[model samples]
Target: MTLYGFRIPKFAALFFWIVVWEIVGQFELMLLFPPFTEVLAAMTDVVTTPSFVEAARITAYCYLVGLSLAVVAGIGLGLLMGLVPAADKLLNMWVNIFLSAPLSALVPVIMILFGMGEPTVIVTVFMFAVWIIALDTRAGVQHVSPSLKEMAFSFGASRVQRLKIVLLSALPEILAGIRLGVIRGVKGVVIGQLLVSIIGVGALFSLYSQNFLMGHFWALILILFAFALSLAELIGRLEQKVEYYAGARG
Candidate 1:
């Protein structure tokens, strides 16, 4: 049969371990790890709390602002750079420096500049991600079919109209870059908050670890993982919608 008699996912492995955990827990092999049942019960409580909602709202706001600005500025600057050889040459060195640097190391410096709060976290996310998104957008523009641009020009399209019609059509690729930027920026938010935030999920994670609440701690990790997966799915759907619209137009 096919690999254990069906199309089984690797995640099925977690179910196996969870069953083993419940058995070991019943036998008192360990308590702090908690049984799968216990952790699931704790998850329902933790995920529903008002405090968790507030923390989620704060994180979402920070992520959106950071991601939105990165998209606008990244695409704008990238287009300009791709269009200008002299500009790329002049800024290439600095761009490479920031891109290569390990942004986690810059959190403290960001904190120094903006203090230990939302501003620091926002700046941290922006610094780590904007360049990569910009680089991708630039590449997308460069690789756009030259024929599409020439058609617009031959049809007497103005510069503004050409950008709006022709260049804008390439947005699905630019959006692909933005999707990556937001994901990368989210990681920065988690790290920045963990390092300096006083009242967010990071604070809760630190508090739980200190109190040795392993089950609850694992619950929080699961929540974050689920949140990230949900976001990626949402972006993937948006990409598909764009493709559908493009096809309909043709």
Candidate 2:
């Protein structure tokens, strides 16, 4: 970023917001918005607590499982849709609808079907993430060069071999979609756990918020935010690394 005549580091804006937050918090503009310093202090304490660790573990488990399912199912279904026009025509409308709809509205239905357990939370995350992945993957597959398919056929490639080649060719877009889907999955897991409210990070948030522990509440949020950002950053780097595949696709 740039000021009048100088450039600022990327994180400068974040620090600026932190300062503003501190000022508002110090002045007691809102009781819920505690000072950043207090939140940091609370974070230190929270990390050392056993309950926090357990909650974090549960959340992590749900996140990993949901993300894995989303990636596999999304890729498989997207490939099917892309390769088969009839399948695409039949499912495209539903995919678009789910992608644009307010998925949180389905939480109650999920709980009813899954009975408010870890399965429900995992399913919630899957619902939140799978559609975008499927869409992106399908688009990538559709865009694969016809010449490449013809070449594979001339070489007498099997169906699985053709798919392997296509997947490699479309890796860039696949990764891009997964990156976005991962971020959405984070939001999904949080929403699911919170809505279910029986155990995990959501329960901790409820306990802290209900007791007016603003610092702890904010600390927990910061932890989740940091974790999500870290995951996104890792995937982003992977995206950059595979960018060479873009040229190869041709």
Candidate 3:
């Protein structure tokens, strides 16, 4: 319905920032911060490079698979905890311990246990993400309206039917936890790559940094920032869409 109001502001902001960057480069503000043009050129060059493509593939692979596993496992564990009080109490302390502990610190142990490989990286991401999701899922299941379950049961719903009809009905809240887990998982997996990757973006970053290619270094970061932002927007929109459709049922 409205188009003219949006593009102008975004274009204006882009130009303003580009002008500021060029001016900062010209003045040599501090002995650091490469020219924006250099960074942009580096970004273009990176996209064309074979190594960059490989690194991108590896990173995306680890993040997507690990995050998926985390979400599925988290939902199952959360539902079990929600339905069983004794299981919840027993798992609570262990969950809290892992949730509070520094996943980054475990990198060394993981490397020792699994050696340097993709599995280790994915596991690191899983470690950083899964507990928070599981905890949130458990809370979501517990908070599901009891009346809904009663209504389902009154219809002679079998145990499986009750779960399918009433328990899994709180998908919105559960998915919220999953979204949070995925965001954290992706970041953790990338960071884990930095710690032990031999052929991912993290490795490329290390290579450029050591060679003093500050332009390329920042260029990689810009790529990652763009990727992260785009993925976040995509998932947020999907979640909203699902919530809207599910709300109609309610």
Candidate 4:
């Protein structure tokens, strides 16, 4: 970032906000926001607790399992839609609808079908993540050069070979979609847990909120934010690495 003709580090904005938060917290400007330092201190305590360890394990399990399912289903659906115009015509409208819908409202339906358990949370994450990934993948596959497919065909490449070529050609957009899906999946997991209110981090959030443990609450939030940002950054790096594929396609 630049300010007054001087370059500023990207984190400078974060630091400034942290300072503001601390000041407001110190002055008791908001009842919901406790001191930042207290929250940091509470973080260590929170992480060390056995309950937190168990909750973390459950949350991680649900997140990973759900996201894995999303990746597989989304990519497959995207490939199908991209390759088959009939599939695209049949499913594109619903995909777009779900992508734009307030997915939280659907969680109760998932809970009813899957039961009020980890399965529900997993499905929630999958639901939140899958559509965008499929859409992006479809876009990437559709944008693959016709000449590339023609060359593959002329070379006697099998159907699977052609599909592989399309996947590689669309790698950049696929990665981009996955990155976005990951972020949404995090939100899904959190929201799912919160709505469920009996499992994972959501349970802990309920515990903290009911008992007025704001410090611990905020600490957990910070942890979630950090995890989401870290994963996004990692995927973004991977996206950059494959950008040449997009250029090649172009």
Candidate 5:
């Protein structure tokens, strides 16, 4: 970032917001916001509680399982669509529709079908994440240079070899999609648990809200935000590392 033609640290904006939030919170400008210092203080107690430990475990399990399914299915579907015009014609409309749709409305339907359990939450996370991953993967695959494929063919590369080449070439976009999917998956997990209203971190959110424990509530939010940002930064670094593939293809 730059201000007045001077370079600013990347975290300057975040620090600025933190100061603003602290000021607003200290002055009781919002009923929902407690002092930021109190929220930070509550973080220790929140993390140490057995209830929070159990909630964290359940949230992690649901998130990882759901995201794993999304990655596999999304990549497979994307490859199919990218490699086969027929598949693209058949599925592209639906993919676009789901990608743009407000998926939260469908959560109730999922709950009805899967019942009020971990399965429903997992499905919610998957639904929130999969479409974008598929779309991005399809784009990556389609963007693979025709000459790369031709070269592979002229070299007597088998069908699997061609597919591997495409995947490697598309690694940058695939990782970008996964990084985005990871973020969406976090929202899914949180929304699923909140709507379920009886399990995981959602239950804790409910507990804090009903009792007006804003400090603990905000602390939990900060933890989730930190986790999501950390994951995104890690994936972004990986994306940077693979960017040479795109340049090579060009």
Candidate 6:
């Protein structure tokens, strides 16, 4: 693959990191960084365990629900703000504030409002994801050309028809936003469950950490990273498929 104009084999960088990790582990440089092989073995054990399966189920539930809510609400609000200048003016400030705010600080408030349960974790994921999506969707809509709207109107297109065309034109940006939001939602789920300290993958992390099971801890982390990366890559491919819509907007 080419990166920054440098050609390298697909797995070369990964192999290099694995070699470095093995060297570190062999020298006993740190108690926490286990060898690559051992970590892979631990991953096998983790995936087969009942606790891992249950934790994964819970995490997936919250992640999917939160992401679904974020996608719907973010798109709806974004369309409103984009099409209506008054709504844009009213919501833009708050959207920017939340987007820039340290959302971790709001976890306690969320817990208090929703209680220390799955709902709290789900809400946390929504909070982390919704703002970027809203902002991106709004930006995408604003970028849609005035001529397209006028053309549609001139063709006797109804309001709903105009909205459909505009949204399709914005699909690339919307997918990009959703991709980013999914990554953030992953973080939100981990943080929310960890703070609660008695549930799901977070509880497994806590258990592994307290017991100094470095292999298991890292394995769980790798699992979550793989899941997040896969989702982002899938959305990214979808964005590519819709690139024609950007030209349609013009």
Candidate achieving the largest lDDT: 4
Off by over 4 Å in 1: 1-36, 244-250
| Residue pairs whose backbone atoms clash in candidate 1 | none
Question: Local error of candidate 5 at 28, Å?
Answer: 1.0
RMSD (Cα, Å) for all candidates, in order, is 3.6, 1.1, 3.8, 0.9, 1.0, 1.8
Q: What is candidate 3's CA lDDT for residue 83? A: 85
- Where does candidate 4 have its weakest 10-residue lDDT segment? 241-250
What's the alpha carbon RMSD for model 3?
3.8
What lDDT tens digits, residue by residue, belong to model 2 across residues 85-143? 99999999999899999999999999999887899999998999999999999998988
Q: Please report, in order, the local distance difference test score of every candidate based on alpha carbons.
A: 0.75, 0.91, 0.79, 0.95, 0.94, 0.92
**Clashing residue pairs found in predicted model 2:** none
Model 6 Cα lDDT, one tens digit per residue, 120-231? 9999899999999998899899999889989999999998999999999888888998999999999999999998636889989999999999999999999999999999
Off by over 4 Å in 5: none
Q: Which runs of model 4 end up more than 4 angstroms from their true locations?
A: none
Model 3: which ten-residue window has the lowest total lDDT? 241-250
lDDT of 4 by residue, 112-224 (tens): 89998999999999999999999999999999999889999999999999888999999999999999999999999999999864799999999999999999999999999
lDDT of 3 by residue, 76-168 (tens): 888888889999999988988998887888888888887889988888888888888888878867777777778888888899987775445
Q: How accurate is candidate 6 locally (lDDT)?
A: 0.92
Ranking by TM-score: 4, 5, 2, 6, 3, 1
Model 1 C-alpha lDDT per residue in residues 1-250, reported as the tens digit of each score: 1586688787888888989988876686875667777777778877898888888888877777777788788888777766677877876567768878888988888889899889887787787678877777676666666677788899999999877763466566676777777778878778888986665677777877898877777788778777777777787778777764243124
Q: Which residue pairs of candidate 4 clash?
A: none
- Of candidate 5, the 10-residue stretch with the lowest lDDT total is 241-250
Q: What's the TM for model 4?
A: 0.98
Full-model lDDT, candidate 1: 0.75
lDDT per residue (tens digit) for residues 24-125 in model 5: 999999989888899999999999999999999999999999999999999999999999999999999999999899999999999999999999999999
Please give the range of 10 consecutive residues that has the lowest summed lDDT in model 1: 241-250
